[model samples]
Target: MPLMLPFAVEELEVFGKCTSGMWVYARNSTGSRSGDKIVKRDIDLCDEHGRVCVRLKGLSFREAEADRNPNPGATFPETLESFMLEPVWKPQAVHTEGESLGYARHLVILCGMTGFSSRDTAKRPGGMQFVQLELSQPDIAERFHACADQVFEMIRDLLTEKPQERVLLQVVVPSQGDQQLFAGLTGLLQSAELEHARLIGQTIILDTDIKFEELVAILEENKISREKRIRYQKGQRFGLSWNELDAKEGDVPVPWKDEGVYLISGGTGGLGFIFAHDILRQTKRSTLVLVGRSALSPDKRTRIQELSDAGAKVVYKQVDVAMEDATHALIGEILRDYGKLDGILHSAGVIKDNYLVNKTTEEMQEVLAPKVRGLVNLDEATKELPLDFFILFSSLASTAGSAGQADYAMANAFMDAYATYRNSLIKTLYRHGHTLSIHWPYWKEGGMKVDAETEKMTLQKYGITAMQASTGISALYRGLASGKSEVLVMEGELTRIRQHLLSEAMEQVIPPTAVSEIKESSSTLVETELDTGNLTDKVLIALKLEVSKLLKIQSGAIDVDLEFNQYGFDSIT
Candidate 1:
């Protein structure tokens, strides 16, 4: 007795046989029929050359069972297995390696479901029925040869078994609303870290009652253009001109005095010390309060004593800002001892590097505690104080979304957002207080643990030059004085930074002409050779040209000795 296929074969085309005895064929068929009417239509299978083979008419379990011979029946295979059927035509010559076979041999798996029925049974209504289509790719199938039997069993179960209602409803009615399916899909694609397999999963929401043809059309469109499924966001770049730097120095006053009390979190760290020393230098009588999780070392204590002797009181306190009660108590103690709270600088944060999938909830919270919760605690404790500045130290990762730094990025992004929110409130409640979040690039001396190899790769491949302590401090001061709620400080050639950021879909945020000018300036330093007089003249001419362009005036109207403020330039510009 001959075996019967579950579905009707409509057409078939044989390409040729490979040396390995594997016969490649294309198939076109329809799925199961309901009451003599075809349910699934235009199901196609072809090779890279567009040759069709094994086309089927329709699929029906009832029809297939009826066609089977009852008396000659034998036990069926428990697993879905492949068996060769005699070719409808003579085999053609074997093709050479790398030859086009006329069909898509690749397979993409999209797994997700849409709303079928509400939990409320009264809302149930009749909907369109769908016929299942089974398609396979030889290349993909070969990859799972070791688990062939298991794969076959899974397919058999899918076709013949009924899942629990709860399990079935999960795919149909996911906890995350259907409207957000696209966002979830793009996120999955972006976060995937596939090394060998070119597979990605995405979610699509469809009405349960959608026509079968429409569903097939949607799947086909996505299959043909996978790139469209991934989404990207635009990012921003920040820079300062030589003229702006000079203007910032003259316009925005630090307002630091010998009697003011300034607090620095993470003060025992390298960056904290630098800021502490700079604050001392800026004022003759100000008091510096440095907070860290550990006690100051003997050497650090001696250094603090020196600053104390220099007339600025230096105090070091051991405190973890993440402890809300402890941070609040510490703030109260400072206010009591100093009679005032002049400023607060938050530089406390932690980092745990791992791929998003591998990151644990505890690790994320550990990083977020000091950065996000600490800020909230500090702000609540000092809400009534007339502070000069409230500065939060953030990172460039918040903007660029660096791979393996999701937790760190999320914490910093919170800081960025909170700073903006605080600034909005400050305009009304504490007009004298400024809330600023500074997004900084890599610092050569002070940062989370970074080995030499990683640093070298970051600089060479990513075009990111770690900021020198002196330059970073200068930029920090300028950023604070600029009166902006948020600022990003970056160090690199603009063109190189732009190129590096292209993968993040943020390259276009920076103007091309600005990058060109920066590139040209750096190139000029290497290529130009001139005498002292000629170089001085060239420098003066370039300065005048830049000023003219900035002021929107002719170069002839610029005077080298005139201050920028005289040309209608202010800190806002």
Candidate 2:
């Protein structure tokens, strides 16, 4: 069985005229075939920024599959009056007018009542009781009501149970009732502002004894096409007039196809991959140009191929962005290939963690190599190009100093300062007509995980560790994108470090020891330790006089390598 059919004669003509296949569906929970397999196509006829129309191919009926079709040996006779009272009786009525007029390629007029079986050879009537009617256009509410004035105007057939054989049910005319039921129905429809509705009961009845053909002719005269005019009226047997159908599809505009390119750095890594996935899922498809050093690797190539297979324009190039010449050349090549760059995300980084004492001067230089020098190289190379974003991956240790990580902290500190300086320069250049935006993210996760011992040591000095850094990076990016000058990635650490530096300055203002006490106390302690662990008053006074003479000589000598931890010594001695 087909899912839906073009029942209205006027809509059928439009369906026949359509070179494109159109389909219909019953808007009922029980008859709904949503999520079922259907065919789709690229079309230019649909309204811009709207959902695509679908064409039904087949059916998966619950009733037929469950062996619940009670009418096994029933055959329907083709007549116009047969449809007026019982449309489902003529289940397989193939209307040439419906097909030739372009109502639909194939359709199924869904019914809640049992349908006649055309497969049986005997042509015997099947036993099934039904008082159901699918009203095309009642100009009433969404559903049928029993007490409404419109209810008294419908014609109905009542079925009685008998033990022997089946019989043609007795017809009931609601018009004979004291109050015309159709007037109540018309009132109900008027309140709802509905053009069509449906009604089902124990017997077949006409809520309004209007024929579908007559309604289509009325709709055609009013310039309403057949497809737009046909709607399955709920609970009411009557169909709607042509002027009632809304011909809205033809007046809207069609939208353009999505076409663009997205550029990404570190596109092969975990965070980069996740970002790419989100971009692909949330937005329309676009060409992707990935910049990374590992693009030359076989594993990276394989992964990129997989992404390409999944409908992404995956492209990669091998270049260490830390090198100036290489970065310049690669940027030139990318610009040549892709006419323009949409955006960029820089996630390249390295970590250097060691105690201050253990760090060599050479190691310090090496640690600063990537962020300080590499960033400058990248900035210089891409400055000429019409680039949209320049993101620098930074660290929290830069703002908050770490105890056992002086080198990494100092290096990151340079990055923090450099980013600000570069961004300022870019803005200044923009005032003179160059457009470029710079961003910086500090302490992101996945680059390096700080251990428990390392975190404790770092926190003692910096007051915040790696996790805070990662979160700060994301927030900083968001804030910067929202047009902030420079966002302190971690507000808490920035405040703490500022306070700590200021407190150390206040301690330097006041004196701790007097100049006279330094001269007397130091001489006495030395003399007492040297002179039999005890000193007479005359001996102590003599020691003080000798210390004065030595102090006068102490200012002249420059090279002195005595054990200063033991006691104070004269440079001349």
Candidate 3:
């Protein structure tokens, strides 16, 4: 192990095999300042073509003059005060096992839960089912890795060997703040998908201190389709809930200080920059510190000026947040120059999408560096600061699961856990700091640039629409004001997403998809021929053609209206 410092021994990633004749460039970008305890250096080893083979995160610190003691208070294990803020879920009410939740009658089966898996429950085949697989809290406490293996075996056996059913996996954990462990398990639950069964991932955090009957009561309550996450503390139950913001409402302020200093990782460009724009608009004249791995380009510089034009001071920092010391040095500099730091919006992360069979451990860690380690570095840097908020930009993929995103999904799961961990120490670690992890869906403008066809297919499959930029910003404002540890801001049919995380149940019961129907309708029109099957098909064609001409897009661009509500009407109606 390397000599201990304020920051130490983060992971290193190798992109390609190193070759001979690689030149190394080293430099210090900033002038030395008096009273500075840390120095940063940037070193890059590049090939003859200037391709970077390896880079070093410049972190140099002086020895402490005297013995340093950071925390004088009681340790975490000695008290339960920090764990008081950990998120919990409550039951709607305990109901009969295998009960219906309006969509259809679901076949309910319990597995791995002691004294409950043996129950003879009736099965109902209404195109969907719910299976609750439990992990004992004591088992998790005693042998975690063994329990982890059990978690795999249970889900694997259920999906592969048992009758096809929609899964609502229920995992129970101890009341302690083992956030990393919790989030890691969540990553496992999120990936519990199969070709036959639609799985709605569910987690229950039942305190070890709670009685067994208390656990039984909560399990009965969770059988209803509406019941998902639930937690019990001292025999009292709490439920996991979600919230959305109306775009028209802006009076609920974005959390900001009056001309206060704020930092955003990944803020030099993309969603980070857009977040800066929204933050400044909501809280004018604030000092914005934008940090990213890359330096500002001409376009980014112009955008920074635009932020300045909006009556805000924007400072851009080039730093690898995955590097612990590099991140700490940057945060220390920000606090020293600005006098007081207010908030942080950690939007930094990378995605390495590959099939689990094809992915290497190195690739997994590379993807996790920006999200898991990056957020941890941010927290360590600002743990003692009197900050107001620290917002993490997480993804629905963590909660809902995304194929070929094992590392990405797991990394995001850590973000969810970090939010819980940080909030637990609100009274101890921070003066006024609160943490939030916004489990976000894809945004229309600032999100990944998907083609319209791909975008349309994804939206239709998920029973959701790509959130507009205004809607996403509005959600940020609401998330900060809501005083919740984690929130998923989404627009769409909640139950549809609940049924299959979007058909990962669609395979079993989903009829003709909207995207497919839209394509068929387009081909029929191009051939200038009717489907000749039914009046409904012809009517849809005519409506789409007329709507397409009005919208100035191709007829194929018009999707089938899957969300036809009884209340839907226009002025013509």
Candidate 4:
């Protein structure tokens, strides 16, 4: 006797008219197709242009020995209604607009209960259960907005229809490692404001070593399982152990040769200039390519001349790196002139500080273009080049969220992920290039624009004493020498910043000693009082006490007029 399985379509509705051309439909059967005994049925409606107008997918399972008697009273709709209510399988309808449509190439309609167990529950418990929708062509601004809105409406409907289980919806756009797609997805998510369900916007990088299973795992661990609203890459080791290797200077080896050519994006900026000077000093005979969007001023020209006089060949190109063609042209010109590309210091970025609610799409793109898109352009342009180092300048704001820098934080977070992804590719290809993303805090001098009030608040609330330009440059050089993929440079009492941080990952990375010392120091400051003596005596006593506290020693150990260098005090301090 043969096994008999019954199935039916419960709901049918046409979304919109279909356009002409070839169409592709993909179904992620992680949860739907499983086990041996089963029944499968697929229904697709095609138009005159050979386009898939509508599609319905169904799957079911039954025991071989179960009653095979067909019920005459069972209607198709009634059977489908019961089947849709069953937890075993759910049906989803997808409408493909075909290649000719100016809107989204594919629009997926998710019906049935929202909540379901993840495909890989053993690897990631409580992970997100989702269906991936792929978008091929780029939609116009208005169309993109409409498409995103439509998707959000469907998600809202699912949430309303099934309130018991958590619904996870993901929009997977094929980016091919382009940052523009990521930026577009981010803008859409920000604009849509879908707060009901767990919404994820991801880019699918093709022709890479990233396996499908690994990608799924990354999505689950980083975005779904974690409580954070935004995530770029998953399974990254956040906090590295602060060891003597990080502090010891000469022990860390510089990888670049003196004759190699070095490039710095945003090389006209304050931090960029400092890094340029430092790199010149490190490799005096190296050729330097300083690319920036602004024309070189007379003062900057003199500075470039000074670097030239100091035995470094300096070249400046006023070009926007965000433009892919322009960046590729610049790299081609550099390779033609220098004969080899050695290293890159990507410090190009812009800032548009605003609350998340007030931030506009243009503002976000302005900040992201130079940082995220610029990095992508450089990576794509230099895939075949033998580069020793590709260092990206990120920010501490990426890991520790900032109140008024949502766009900046997201941009830097992309850099963090890009570095990791690029490094993985490099390893797979057996390449000799190193990629590192340095997350830096504010510098006392030559940092971002901050008002006096904001600076004071930063110091008081976050205990982030700004790092000096010299100290920060030294740390950067040390990081490059260490060959670490990611390094975070921050200077301050770790305890104060730790208290302000709400991230569990960050809390785990902080050393216990740093926390205890801050607690002890706070108590000491409370206990110690100003001396009630003459004005001169009070001043002297207060100065001694401050020095003692700064040095982490008792007040009795301080001596006035002593050489500050003996106590590790530099001119900037």
Candidate 5:
């Protein structure tokens, strides 16, 4: 083994490639055999195992230090309480010296961790090697490597950048087992007469008996005032605790997720556009796929071009989930493009004023196709994508009944039941984070009303349209992207309706006066269906007028009584 050098190496990243599962491909700057400037190399850590693990390549010690202290506005790990922060390695080009030139700093860090792994079995993953530990644990049967003590030695070995600088370890003892082990280790170190090894807070605080005084000395030595370092430490403490904002779960930290994907329906619609835009802005190197029925308009094409320019990798396709073939084709395309799908947001549906009894069978199918059949279609299409989430965009009307919207309400109710069943199935298959069913209250704008007349109805009824002339595909996309099932009810009649729904569901207490008043309400509020085969002006007027009234707006004024449009709407009534 090489002579030990005291170099400060506190900030460490544990990234490895899974040979059998996932591997990172590195581009060589200079190829020895092919004379190629860029050559691909598979960086798998293990071979013949279930998974190959690989570490990050070409990390320089100097660059790692800079990365650890990136800027004045750097974000630190919330779990770290009061520890020295410095990068163990930095990003750089790999030299011809191979492992000898590249992993010098990494090797040092590995040495400290090895020491810890040598003692305990649980802390160590099997098949790892160290300079001192040749003997493996006998009690362990599954590919046993070094114990926890060995891991600690490797970790401590890498913590020093300079002999003069002292390394501070911030150990988060979440469980009693960890706390007990740490205490035992500290006691053993003290008995061994090690010059270092001092207990600080709740855990073993090495290198400092009094952090306040030691921090002052460090600040003064490093040319920083005590007041500044104190403020900085206080700020860090505040931020670390701030992660406990939603402190329902214990203080024990959850491991960070490196990468994820979000699959959204109606991604090309107005709502989806907003969601994609925000995601592109918020996330790093995340791909957003927009699923919709309509082809991109020229204006939307421009937006997509902008997203592409911004390096969003935005993908859009016109596939109506109502069509089984289209849904199957979409699934195939997604699998081919991305190896696995992570999240899904179902936001495709159609809305029209058609009461169940009054609506013609054809008209009923037209509205229900997207909500009922389309939801099932989406479920089938996304079955293959190792789905992290399968969310449905249901409506509050699924809970609370709306007048003259029997078809729409029924469609939404089916959506609720379908979501519940699918969620149950997913839990049985792959139980993960809270699988949820979300219901969004009626939006004033967006696709809430597809046409200008629908817009008029919304304005008249609610006095404001929550929807954008375009739909809010993006908001729904965001809700699903977040891995939560939530009902985003706006702050108006929609909220009221949602509350009413919950109340009715819990108590079944429909007020008698309210029911009688509903019964006595104008019949115009009731939807009148049009007979598709029967040609009459009354049908046209009924369709438009009833729809308009439900929207709380006046019907469109036409000069002629009803003249039929191509889709069988009579203009000359």
Candidate 6:
């Protein structure tokens, strides 16, 4: 089966009438259809008059092989569940107390808040209600995260009033769920909300464009279940799901280069050093450049010495990826020293898990800077330094949603999209090397997991047995060879794993995007001619409100004429 993932679709610049119909043409932007490919072109729907009536811009298609279908047989038949339901949990602490809580790397509940009332029952007859949130509007793409901030805040406040009550948050996302990175913000937010909801109370999300009667049926169903629910807005999709590396692929020699200089961000600890050991031992002649924000600890120095004793060169750069200047300078220095960079392994990330109510904007950024902003910086610095491959170490949380990890989920989600974006650039710009993002499952070690009990609980809850170092290392090599933009390693059988994931109550046919109905998505929204090219006042107002909601600030503060950078645009990534 053919598969398509639309990165962005704005039917902008529609003018001529298509009543008589128009020709729909898809040109393979990539000259050759070999291995992994990305198709970027303007699909103009023109009428008999040869006038462009409808235009679709920036939608990309990637192939697993021969313009390959990454997950050949995985996609939903009836597309775009514009309206669906999702479940969430509230936070235990106040909305403004994150910096104080010093949240643990893993799940942690907020406490010490007053004025919240507890009650029985997650929902009642009248309690089965919802609020509309349209996060799919194209114009807000630049400020999507800012917009997400507002939605999450609203969720925080709504649930804050009555922590023990169950409320449904009706969410509107583009047909492309997680693949459409901007719209995926809602997925991350819902996941984060659910994360918090699991800790506090109940706040669910629903994305629908169905008839009101159908919605009523869903509501009645909600009333009956008394259990939390979240409709999979996007259809059946499988591109982001990673496959376990069979012994053959894992046994294939790793992507090692003799005398190659490899850069590993977030390379100081956990998987970083583990890879360093592999590279030094396997790629004995290569120079491993490790990047981390922390100073070298004595224990780390000893490990480096051991690797050095093995033969390869090991160097560490204490720099924060969030700081572009420092990051760029480090890359620059590396290029100067090594003449040419062979590969990049971006595994740098930070975790600050807290419920939405307790997490402040600063806290959110704190978690995002390393993965989101930092990746942008890395891209800017390395865009000129073409090499073999650019590997991003992503997480399953972005796919499954993590409580108290909206920022983290949002960041990784961005990475998932960025990998595809970078690959498109590679094809169009004639850049060397491919970009692959491996959305990994929980590792048996170094995921900041200290206790064995927590690991066991993870298995019990998600049916995800922690991955061993050897297995993950082999999977990493297999992902590098896969050629696809993103490979989310799916461990075990889907049938059994689905059982555990359903325990999280998030196993709907999460809509599979372009393969679904874009028409249905646009037709359902009544007062919003969102898909049109001519940007209207209502559209602008809606966008302003979107950002305003995210910032929890006044819409008036956003000047339409001002450059987005003037308002601190770097954080938007």
What lDDT does each candidate get? 0.51, 0.37, 0.60, 0.55, 0.41, 0.57
Once superposed on the true structure, which residue ranges of model 2 sit more than 4 Å away at CA?
1-271, 294-306, 403-407, 430-445, 452-477, 490-573
Off by over 4 Å in 5: 1-259, 355-358, 430-435, 449-488, 492-573
Candidate number with greatest lDDT = 3
Write the residue-wise lDDT of candidate 5 on 1-573 in tens digits. Answer: 111112222233444533423434444322322232222232334445434354434321111011233563532222211100111112222121221111111111111122233343332222112232343333211001122234233333432222233222222111121111122122212211122222111111122222333332322222211010111222122101101112122233211122446667877665566656666776667777788788889988898889879876777888888887888887777778876567776677676663222344456456667765676676766664566666666665544445455446546655554554455556566333333445564454443533434433333333323443123343443344444333343322333333333433322122223222333442433333333346566665555444443433224322122222211222232
Judge candidate 4 at residue 179 and give its lDDT. 27
Lowest lDDT sum, 10 consecutive residues, model 3, at 75-84
Number of the candidate with higher lDDT, 4 or 5 = 4
Error of 5 at 26 (Å): 77
TM-score of each: 0.48, 0.35, 0.55, 0.52, 0.39, 0.55
Query: Considering summed lDDT, which 10 consecutive residues are worst modelled in model 5?
Result: 238-247
**Tell me, what's the RMSD of every candidate?**
28.1, 44.9, 20.7, 27.4, 34.7, 25.5
lDDT (10s digit) by residue, model 6, range 1-573:
333334434346767667635677655343424233455666778776676777776544443223122663632122211111111222211112112111111110111111112331122223333333334533323245555566657656654664453344433333233224443454455575565542222222334344344444443332222222233332221112223333354345478778989999998878998888878767658999999999999998888788878877888899998887898899889978888898989999988887766778778767777877787788778887768888988877766577778778777877877786678778777456788887777666664443444443343333445666776777777767767777666443344455544432321222212102222232333244365556676577566555544544334445444433333333222
- Assess candidate 4 and give its TM-score to the true structure: 0.52
lDDT of 4 by residue, 1-573 (tens): 233333333234454476544354544233544344544445455665656677666533333232223863431112100000000111211112211111111222211112223443234333434443234434222223333344444543543454443334444332334322332333333322233222323322222234446545444333312222222333232212222233445665655567879899999888878878777777758888999988989999898899888888988999899888999999999988989999899999998876544556677668777876688788878888888889998876765456566567667766766676677778778444888888877766776746544444354445556666766776776777666666777665455444444333343333433323433564443234443567777677666556655765534434443444335453456
How good is model 3 by TM-score?
0.55
Error of 4 at 508 (Å): 9.2
Cα lDDT of candidate 1 equals 0.51
lDDT of 1 by residue, 1-573 (tens): 222223333344444432312234423233334444223344434445555433333322212122232553432222211111110112121212222111212222222223222232222212212212122323211111212222223322332333221111001111122222212222212222121112222323344445434444443333322121221112111121111123234554654666779999877777777787778888878888888887778988887788788777889989888787899999999988989989988998887876554555567567767776677778877989888889988876665455666557656766765676677777678434888888777777876536544544354444556666776676666777776766776654444444544433322222333323433453343234223457778777666556645644434435454434445443444
Better of 2 and 3 by lDDT: 3
Between candidates 2 and 6, the lDDT winner: 6
Candidate 1 or 4, higher TM-score? 4
Q: Write the per-residue lDDT of candidate 2 for residues 1-573, one digit (tens) a residue.
A: 322211111111111233234334424233334444321212222223333343222222221011123663321111101000000211111122321221111111112112323332122212222233444433212112222212222211101111122122211223212112122222111212111111111122222343434322322221211111122233233322111112122323211113445555566665555555545544466667777665357877787787777786778866666667887787777678867555555555554554432444456455545544555566666665555455555444443344445445444444444444445556647311121222222233444454544443343343444443334333433533443323333322443334443443332221222222334455643454466634564554455445444453211121121122112332333
CA displacement after TM-score superposition, residue 14 of candidate 1 (Å): 34
